[model samples]
Each structure stands twice: as structure tokens, then as C-alpha cells.
Target: MNSFCNVKSVMRSMFSGFIAATVILISTYAIAETTMEKVKRTGVMTAGNSGSYPPFSVMEGKTLLGFDVDLANELGRRMGIKVKFEVIDFKGIIASLKAKRVDTLITAMTKTPGRAKQILFSVPYYDAGLGALTAKGSGILKPEDLTGKIVGVQLGSSGERYVRSTLGKKVKQVKTYDAILLAVQDLKIGRVAAVVNPIPVLRYNSKGAQLVTTPVWKRRAVGINTRKEDADLMAWIDKHLSAMKNEGFLERLDKKWFEG
Candidate 1:
């Protein structure tokens, strides 16, 4: 009888220890914050962009407004932190992010090999293509049509890359501007025969110009870029983006901003 009682007591102690270990395991999985948690603990998320880029991130009367702006704020809100956006020249956005001046990039930045080497990109959120904007009656109907003509493109943009690689040699000159809107301005005034930019931008900024859909670059995707080794932050971002896509929120943004 004594031996059986001792065995029963030992079994109870072992079971209690097992239960405590399981609880600790569950707590660790549940509470161990990933990279995202560090950002949350700091109570802030900084996003970088070139606010001069219209439709995606534009500065209007001291207020930053556009699709990317909204999306950045949404991510901040979801993360339960305040979002601060840093607007600078497009060429420096990636540099600033790399230097840790900002947490991530929110501009309509394309996912390219060169960029990927510096930072990790979230799943693509938007697809952009290089398009031409020509003044009315300019006769710039297509990529070939712009041959031997001065073409304008936004500095540090995919449009600029497309022109340099595919259209620059044929064109009289490849004029680079700080913003696509500036290129469109030049296009309207005959400074260049055409302005090369993303199609969605041309859709909104082509006042006296006609958008030529014969693209120079086709279907490049845009996504938020985070610092290397930011696995938790990247995971959080992807999960939120996927949820938005599934819920039709992303579609609504495209319709409201890109289509309009």
C-alpha cells in the first residue's frame, strides 16, 4: 500500500510539471514579438516616399494624400502605432530606408532585382507599366513613333530605365525630371515629344496630353520594401496585404485612385 501511494504522488507531480511546461511553451509562441513587435513597442512606424509623385503619393497644400499614403496609415493603424511619412527625392528613398532613416518605403516602388538586393519586398500590391504621354496631335502613337524625338522621364523611375535601355538610343535626348508630372509639363509645352511614366500617372496627369498605351515597360509590380532580416515585419505586412486583397479593399483603392 505504501509503495502504491508513493507512485501515485510521483505521477501527480510529473503531471503538474508537464502542464506548466506546456503553458510556458504556449505563452512563448503567443507572446514572443517578432520584428513587428519591436516597432510596436517603439510606438511608431516611419514610411518613406517621394511626395511629388502624383496619384501614389502627392503633396497638396501641406497635406500628403494618395493611395500609398492611405495604405501606410492603414498599416500603422493596424499595428497600433503612429505612422510618420518622410518625403524626399525618389532617388534617395531606398538609401534613406537602408540607412534606417525610415522603417519602410511606401512609394510606388517597383520590385526589381537591384532593389531586392538591398531590401526585402513584400508581396506585390500594385502592377505598373511604362507608358507615354504625348501632346495632342504630337503623332507619338507608340514606342517606335517617339524615335528620334526628345523623351522625358521621371528621374530614378522605371520609365527612365526603359527609355535608357529601350528608347534612349533612338531618341534625340532622354530628359530626366524630378517628377513625372514635370515631364508631363514638358510634354505639353513641346520640350519633349513625349513623357514616359507609369500608365496610372498618365491617366490622371494627362491634361493636354494623350496617354499612349503602347508601353515601353510592361506589368512591373510594386510592393513595400523593408530592411533585410525584418522577417516579422514582413510577415505582418504580407498578412495584412493579403487580407486587404481578399476583402476587396485593394480593388477599391485601384478603382478609386488608378481608374479614376
Candidate 2:
């Protein structure tokens, strides 16, 4: 009778332990869906951007346009789903992604060593670097010429870091704007001496501003940003970009947008 009781108690304890372990695994699995799986399940992927950078992503009378817009759409197409873009602030993009507010980032986000610590990137899709735009004929001949002048960059962007890292103490003041367009606008109105950002952005919005030609700082490869845990989705994006490069599809896109 004593032996039987001990055996029964051991069996019950083992069963309870197994149940606890099973519960934990289930809980983890419930919240562990890959970005790709979630996209497929919902029939859409949300691409986040500021919609403030032109010729890459911009808001034109409620319609989003530019290279990144088409890129997100293509990504969705390849996955056999639809893509929806959320106009989030540039500074909040990464936080939103980590919090699961976005499936991927299509903003002109560059692949930097610092950013790589928080997010994964697809292969480089464009050759990109930083440039400065100032009021026409401002005599800011080179990047170094910005010394003693106020330079503006979008807050929480590589441009901000570029000035601090490359031109630290050379410039009198570093102004930060919520949008790179605002930096450009400030440069136009003499609020800031210059706006530093992607070369494409500076070039496209240089209508009333002058683009600096002497120095292209912070040259980098730009790619889609995904959550670090979404290995499957990142792989898919890298593969898609690779195919686009090999098939000349990316060339056509560059020609249509950049060459235009």
C-alpha cells in the first residue's frame, strides 16, 4: 500500500511538470509569429515611413510617391499580399517597428553599424550618401564651409550624426528638425544656414536651395529595415532585392526615378 501511494504521488508530480512546460511553450508560440507569417495571415504588410522625404517617399495631396513607395508595393506583390504604408515620424520609426506597430520600414533608412544593432537589413538597393542644401549663392563651397554656420538635419537621422561626427565643432550650431523637409525649408527662409541629408533629398528639394557639390558625406547602403527577430522575413526581403538586382528590375526603377 505504501509503495503504491509513493508511485501515485510521483506520477502526479511528473504530470504537473509536463503540463507547466507545455503551457510555457504554447505561450511562446502564440506570440512568436514571424513578420512574414503575420503578413500572410493578415493579407497585408505595413511599411512605415515619414512620407516627408521626396524622390524616395513624400506625401503629394494624400498620395504617397517615390522610389520607396514602389519598393514596398513590390515586396507585398512578391509575397502575394497587399502593402499598406503608415506615415510615422522618422524619429519614431524604429521604436514603432520594435513595438510591432510596423512590419517593415521602407523609409530611406540607411544601413549603419549603429542601426544594425537594433534591426536587420536587406541588401543594399541604392547607392546613397549625405549632401547639404543651402540658400543659393551662400558661398558654402564645401562641407567644411559650414563652419560658424547653423546646419540643420532631421532629428534622429544619420544626417544629425554625420554633422556631429564629421563636422563636430566646425559648425557653430546644429539645428534639428522633425523632418528633413523642414530643415530644407529653414534653409530657404534663412532660419538655418544649411540642411544636411541624403543626396537625393537635397537634390530634389533644391528648387530654391543650392545643393553642395564638393562633399558627399556619410556614403552608405540603404535597405529595408526589419525586426531582428524576423529572420524569415529578412531573408525573403534580401532574396527579393537580389532578384530585382539580377533581373534589371532595379535598374529600370533607378532610371525611372533617379534618371528622370
lDDT of each: 0.81, 0.83
TM-score of 1: 0.81
TM-scores of all predicted structures? 0.81, 0.83
Q: Which ranges in model 1 have alpha carbons more than 4 Å from their true place?
A: 1-37, 208-217
Q: Ten-residue segment with the worst summed lDDT in candidate 1?
A: 207-216
Choose the strongest candidate by TM-score: 2
Measure candidate 2: CA RMSD: 5.1
Report the lDDT tens digits of candidate 1 across residue range 1-260.
99999999999999999999999998996567544665777888788889988788899988999999888777677767877888879978888888878888889898767788989999888888767777666676677787888988888888888778776588899999998888877776679887877787886887434544444446678999889978678888888887777888778888888777
TM-score of 2: 0.83
The digit string of per-residue lDDT tens for model 2 on 114-212 reads 899999988989878777777667887577888999999989888888889888998999999887777877777788888887777677677533445
Q: How high is the lDDT of residue 18 in model 2?
A: 100
Query: Whole-model lDDT, candidate 2?
Result: 0.83
